[model samples]
Target: MLRVLAVDDEKPLLEELLYLLRSDPRVRSAEGASDATGALRRITRALEAGPDGDDGIDVVFLDIHMAGLTGLDIARLLAGFARPPLIVFVTAHEGFAVQAFDLKAVDYVLKPVRPERLAEAVRRACAQLGRATEAPAAAAEGPPGGPPGAVPAVPGPPGVPAAHRPAAEVTAADRTPEQIAVELGGVTRFVAIADIAYVEAQGDYARLHTDGGSHLVRIPLSTLEERWAARGFVRIHRRHLVALARIDELRLDAGTTSVRVGSAELQVSRRHARGLRDVLMRQATG
Candidate 1:
């Protein structure tokens, strides 16, 4: 069951949100806090207690305007932590909507909440969690001959729950579905994930290969492996994680296997050979 914390200076509103959150069977428990200080204390204590010690909180419903340390401040503080709960802004003011999105907030609900809206927000939060958790496996399953970001079209509005409406529509504006930041000649460039062919490891950094050109990033290959592995990248070698579709050919040389990607030939290490073979075999049969 999902756990939640609702923070608002207004007593009645807090109670009302708590009631609505509790109505969902998926929500195991909901805690209410009237101020930012108290909310921080509660969160810190809960974290100290550990996951098994307490039921644990999955999301936070925050009010932007509060007596002290505004909701944005609270969100920033939570963001500083190792693992922060998904934040959903609950506010009467609409002005902060843009700011809320800047923080990548899970959702924003207007004051005097409606039951359906609140329920929808919760569902979206859950769906985001599922997507995050399943990304690596999904990335590993992309067609053997497709680009790394090649995903079966996520069926449209009906396929996604109402809670995910905003996210679903995001691709309309940007063709690339995932977020990517690249650095070139000391200038950082933000590229859409869709444009990337594959990300290659370059020592401490990883180079992002796109239709345009290749750009370098400071993030470790392992980190990218974990993050994009779910999207459609497979580690053919320690230094290479190629987009399955970008693979032009796969040749097994005695006991050694080599995959042809774009203009590069990436060797599959012994450790990854069997897994890569199985993935290719499954894609071929499917």
Candidate 2:
């Protein structure tokens, strides 16, 4: 079991996080703080009280962007402490993964927090704390045909079930697929869109490369380019689609441009080089 302190400026998100954390069997207690200042105070008190004390917090799930002091600043401060709680950064932006890595964070969870995703973070925290844990049952509470942690549908007017409601009444999020389905050895499995680092085209198929492994899908690279464009994926080459957020380095050697994603260094075609550079520059500046 773990004692957690979830910190976020938004009241609704903070409450939602607390609810999810409490539901997890691995959690002993879940607490909340509105801002970094309050979170730091609680952490300080916990440290003073010692590890076995009831006031101690085992982990802190913190939001990256806040009003006064950012999560990174708080992490730096905690790093100096003799004994600091484990950190898990929760944020809407995907640009802070590197900073989070440098800060030695346990996990980096994106916004619109999914139950299964958060469960994985908790699992990592448990591992670091030398506690063994089985897979989380957080997804068990999710509605059928929806991702874990998705809100349940509300009933329609006049005692009608929500499932019988009109299509127009459903939100866009309900129609979107957060994970991509791929078939391997006659077994079909889903892959989270955020996990894909890059896509490589192979005639009629596209290979989705993730940190764990790669999966070949029937979708074309061109199709993925248009569909994932809004998701920070850019066409770096005719046969390659790279996720902007996953780009670790951009190199220009002898007038040729290339970008590094994970352990792979992908070449940027001359036609798309300028476009890729522009997008990356904009992201860096902003």
Candidate 3:
């Protein structure tokens, strides 16, 4: 069962959202707020009361365009919480989905508030929360060849979930696809996205370096840059798609800026320099 909080500045819309949420079997309870301000207050109170307390909310269905503090602003604030509630953005416009997903929102539902769409969102939230509660137990079980005190990829397979992944990979509010198809040594297998550190372009194909090993795939680097960019993969150089969260350090010596990810140092070109800096800044502040 899930507890959800619905926030919209419009009273009737907020009520309607709460009503729809309450109609679903997955939702154990629902609460409403007229704006982000009230939503934050309630969430704070809930967090102070603890997860087992009646006030704790498992998910938040937020309106992106509310006056004063917009949903994006609210999401960023929540992202910093020690145990942040999953966020789902509800809005009348589609323009904000990418940003919302980047902020780790589980799902984005464009408004007119269809009960079916909202229900799907609730289902996703339930799955996400389940993963959150169960993942720690999986980590406790550990894996073959994983370092001591380190959570790692599931033993005997690239097809299973990976652990201790950067927040940018697993923090998305919903259940994104767990595996991506990759070929290595003429054998194809599903690789967990969380295991990949960065991608390097080699002519037409790209190399995916995981914590355990590396694999080559037939996908173009440009396509991946656009597709996974929202998920923290950024083109630091013309030939590399580095995971922003995996970056260990940025070195600025001798007039060139380079990022150290794992053991490799990749140069950041002038064209993409500021964008990378801005990403790091947002991560720092958020």
**TM-score winner among the candidates?**
2
- Candidate 3 per-residue lDDT, tens place, 186-228, comes to 1225667778889988655567888877765546778778878
| Model 3 per-residue lDDT at 170 | 28
For model 1, the superposed segments whose C-alpha errors exceed 4 Å read 50-55, 131-286
Backbone clashes, candidate 1: 7
lDDT of 1 by residue, 1-286 (tens): 5788999987645755776676565567899999999999988876776544574678899999999799999888878777778899999799999989888899999865655567668778888776232222322332123234333433334333211224224234233447653322111234676566677776555677876677555466776677677777888788887777677788899889998877767788999999988888898899
Best by lDDT: 2
Relative to the true structure, candidate 1 reaches a TM of: 0.45
What does the lDDT read for residue 62 in candidate 1? 96
The local distance difference test score of each candidate is 0.69, 0.78, 0.72
Give the TM-score (vs. native) of candidate 3: 0.45
User: Candidate 2: lDDT of 92?
Assistant: 84
Better of 2 and 3 by lDDT: 2
Candidate 1 lDDT score at position 159: 33
Model 2 regions more than 4 Å off: 135-286
* Prediction 1 global C-alpha lDDT: 0.69
To one decimal, what is the Cα RMSD in angstroms of model 2 from the true structure?
Answer: 17.0
